[model samples]
Target: MNNFKTESFDLNRAFLLDSSHPPSSIVTKLHPLNKIMAEGQIHEDIPLLVMELDNQAIAFITPQLAYQHIVQGVLNGQAWLVSFCSICNGGAVFSPLVDDEVYSFQEGGFYDAMVLLYDVQSGSYWDHLTGNCLYGSLVGKELKRLSNLLHMSLRQVLAAYPDALLALSALPEQQQTEAEEDEAWRKASEPEWSKGLVKTLGVEDNRLPRLNMGLGVWTETTRRYYPVAQLYAMNNVLIDMVDGQRLITYIDPLSGTPGAFFTDASQAEWQHNILQLNNGDSMRDMVIFDANMMLKRPQRPFQLFVRWYSFALKFPNCEIYGQPVNTQG
Candidate 1:
């Protein structure tokens, strides 16, 4: 046998829709409950036993891979993340069972590390898990700690069945109103290849390269964060934060946007091209406001490069696609 070494198993490559992408033969089966994830509502409600292909450990990360970039830091012992706001009572719901498994703080903190966002505009970064003091660097420092807590290496449980979900309440009032507005706006902007955003969530096809950021699907309520996404869901790039960068991951031969003037060919190649565009740009003074905070409705992504990009600051420096281009196109 050829000696091939794979450190970690790719969840996406393994969950291929068809046989086009060769199977690794190592299949993990989940129960109907654990495997429950509908596109219409992108809910990241389960705790994923993430580990490497063999017995190597990753961490107890919720299947929510989009919106938030969870690297599992040292201080954050077995934590859960969501976009909910407990005080507002209008945020998304965090898996209480999963939360019980994670650690909590005493510096006047909420037991709920991951708060759901019923109101995307009112979301506060400092209150969220991303800004937690535990995370130091992006490297795998925290992920390693989270992995050590699990007993049966994730690999062993790979082919096992799924699990169950706990009782979770709905988002509060102010949050619901915002969510509806966000939903209304999402439906307004329809992608050329598919229907509007709302419809796309319900229609599941490998057509869109997707990743679930604990926030579930892109609801009108949470569409504000969609502009700065890092993952995919429903084949559409959910969290695209390319303020001064370009947007292109890999080439989806079928859905690939040509190197046109309005849309560059560069976006068709690289996945997070936005990162490349703003290679040396500093995010110190950068301020990202909710697009709908003023409109009171959901709208298309900030693709056309809104006027906010033109804001003038004292030492504001920016770039895109690796080169220094106009922040406001």
Candidate 2:
């Protein structure tokens, strides 16, 4: 029930390819088998934000690339912003258009404990979560969000779209090297909560550790948090009611990221760790399933995966699941 505008931003700039090191498209050389092998060598447990464009799948979007605000062009002259904040474990994909002009975003340091994004077009800062232009020419403008993003493992993505193209394989050699260096630097600067690494401006919740990962969902009047550890303890799936909507949340046991969907259907039963719906449909991957039992096409009531601390800082009134209830009489 969040009362927000859903107007589509004008796409003046069709693409935002890095000027000095333009990305090369290798669709002809992309094969599922080969890309899967390369991804396995890097890390099978790492998740990728997978999207389908013009019947071709765009995969191999690592968290490192997201943290770097790497904008890549896909089919139909559309560009995608793969954004991730390492400090808060916040990951989201957005269309890079603000107003009529397409903008390229880079890490613009931090503002109020949240990552601020700087656009090359207007030199404005934007809030990554809300997509609001905080400063510069396009102030108060918001970015449009793309739908049906499969934030799951590369293996699951390849299995779902066997013919999906590997976008990372097309990245320039020098850019690839720079991406590796950025990841290394990030790892070396792990947040230390004891030293006040994560700061919250307002009241705080002490229900869980500040650094734990939490999947957050916000409605117009309510906000909810699902801690990763609690989801794992609940057999990797939690069916709950939020803001009068019934939601089924699934957490990949291997990757630990959560994806949720709305379904009036009963709780899905698991056999051999595979989710089986009442209509005889079975799912082996972490992609959200719709009411029709189709995978990768998540229905209404989507959720955002982020760190517990970030959720608390952004939505302090959010209800935390799995907190111990008082039983003493």
Candidate 3:
């Protein structure tokens, strides 16, 4: 592995490859959810990268995002970058402000079988998963990620916020249809079909199946992976320790999406997405009671509902829930 050290990241050049896309493919455009929905241009079942600002929902449809790779835009007066990696099945929303300056990105390349983005302003490369600058002048600099970035279906998002603004496809209908078809094929092709992608990933970690899906929870100090199948076996709710914080990880039956939240309670149980805390209160979602009414606590921990290979590669030695710890020094 060729190491390029930065304050925040050490990039390995061995597995990096140039992507077939040009830089800044999709930048700064949005349409109201009502308008796009009325046009019959969106699929309600597809998951979107969603975020809320002052109760206003902003969503990016995968059909549009997969073709674009990177979508940059302003929402609620803040610059944001929404990225989707079809290979990793990972989506992230990042703050494009670097050193207080708004930066634009293009499809820089790929590293460790994941997408790498480069800021148009400084020509530096960044890891889309962690938003850390790995190569170029901005090395060690990282994008501030919106911790509440959510992976939710348009149907679920609309149910919660009907007034959402969507980032719809700007491409021709034919191109959009083609992109959707390609996405479907990528999902349908199983373990054997992805051998090509697996080959690009240098130094495989066989602790878990390369394509296993899981929720990866992390903090600055440590990280952990919660495999989806294991969560189902445990009734979809688990109380665990991460970075010295006691937390809960569970799959919401309604959406079948995983979520992690900080908690002080000892244990919890869930049925049909309703979490029955050990305390008297019951939580329908990630929100728990705030310590003080005046101050709002973060509802969920920093996490990514990603595939096993992506998480395992990006975060080496990350603990796997329900598995014994690796005691190697």
Question: TM-score of each candidate?
Answer: 0.24, 0.72, 0.81
lDDT by residue for model 2 over 195-264, one digit each (tens)?
A: 2233322334666766677688766775778887778788878788877777777776555567777666
Worst 10-residue lDDT window for candidate 2 reads 9-18
Better of 1 and 2 by lDDT: 2
User: In what order do the candidates fall by lDDT, top score first?
Assistant: 3, 2, 1
Instruction: Name the 10 consecutive residues with the lowest summed lDDT in model 3.
Output: 1-10
lDDT tens digits, residues 25-125, model 3?
55456788867877887755676777666677788776667667788888768787878777777777788899899887878767667777877777778
RMSD of each: 20.8, 7.4, 4.5
Two-way TM-score contest, 1 vs 2, winner: 2
Candidate ranking under TM-score, highest first, comes to 3, 2, 1
Candidate 3, pairs of clashing residues: 23-106, 24-106, 28-72
Q: After superposition, how far is residue 285 of candidate 3 from its true place, in Å?
A: 7.1
For residue 57, give model 3's deviation from the true position in Å.
3.2
Off by over 4 Å in 3: 1-21, 25-29, 38-41, 53-56, 189-196, 283-298
| Count of clashes in candidate 3 | 3
Better lDDT candidate (2, 3):
3
Q: lDDT for model 1, please.
A: 0.22
Q: Which portions of model 2 miss their true places by more than 4 Å? A: 1-46, 52-57, 148-150, 169-190, 193-205, 219-222, 287-296, 322-329
Clashing pairs in 2: 2-220, 12-100
